[model samples]
Target: MSRYVVSFMKDVLGGNGRQIEVCQKTLEIDASSEGEATELAKQKFCKVEHLCEWSLHADRIQIKSADFTS
Candidate 1:
């Protein structure tokens, strides 16, 4: 398993069809793949926030491999 960072993002639309992604929350997870990490993060987030859907809290999700130096 690899460490991944999952982010819950909120999107804002501006003038002329401009879009911006604002990160609302981030989670560190251990998963075999990026897709798995995203799924796990969403489930965990929803459970912790007492929501039935992950979309209720954020517009989208982003995941990346976490780089750590020891």
Candidate 2:
């Protein structure tokens, strides 16, 4: 298994169709492949994001990218 960093982001749309990110969280996970790590991270994201007071719709939240670090 390899270590990966999954970046979770909240869509912050600025002027002129530019996307900004005001909120983000990175999760370190160990998985056999990037796909598996992405899935696991998404699951974690859902559980963690809901604990906050902010209302983050599914559309507003996304896994920006997942990178294998090790």
Candidate 3:
């Protein structure tokens, strides 16, 4: 298994009135492939009840997968 960085992105206007992609959450997953890593991320990474910041600024949640095969 290899390491993968899975990120959940949120596009929102910052305090400066500029749109930026904010990483709501990120996880390092040890999986074989990108697809597997993404699946693992989705299954394991979930929002906590107390963590409402992600939900508030996120218009949409997008998952990104990057493999660390080195």
Candidate 2: worst 10 consecutive residues by lDDT? 57-66
Give per-residue CA lDDT, model 1, range 1-70, as digits (tens).
8999999999878676899878878999999999999999999999888999999879988888996779
Q: Looking at model 3, report the run of 10 residues with the lowest lDDT sum.
A: 48-57
Order the numbered candidates by lDDT, best leading. 1, 3, 2
Cα lDDT for residue 33, candidate 2: 80
In the order shown, what is each candidate's alpha-carbon RMSD? 3.0, 5.0, 4.1
Model 3, position 65, has a per-residue lDDT of 50
Per-candidate TM-scores read: 0.78, 0.58, 0.63
Give the distance in Å from residue 61's predicted Cα in candidate 2 to where it truly belongs.
8.5
Q: Write the per-residue lDDT of candidate 2 for residues 2-70, one digit (tens) a residue.
A: 777766656677887898775567778788887888778777776887643324533333333345356
Using TM-score as the measure, the top candidate is: 1
- lDDT per prediction? 0.90, 0.64, 0.65
User: Which candidate model has the greater lDDT, 2 or 3?
Assistant: 3
- Going through the candidates in order, what is the number of backbone clashes in each? 0, 0, 0
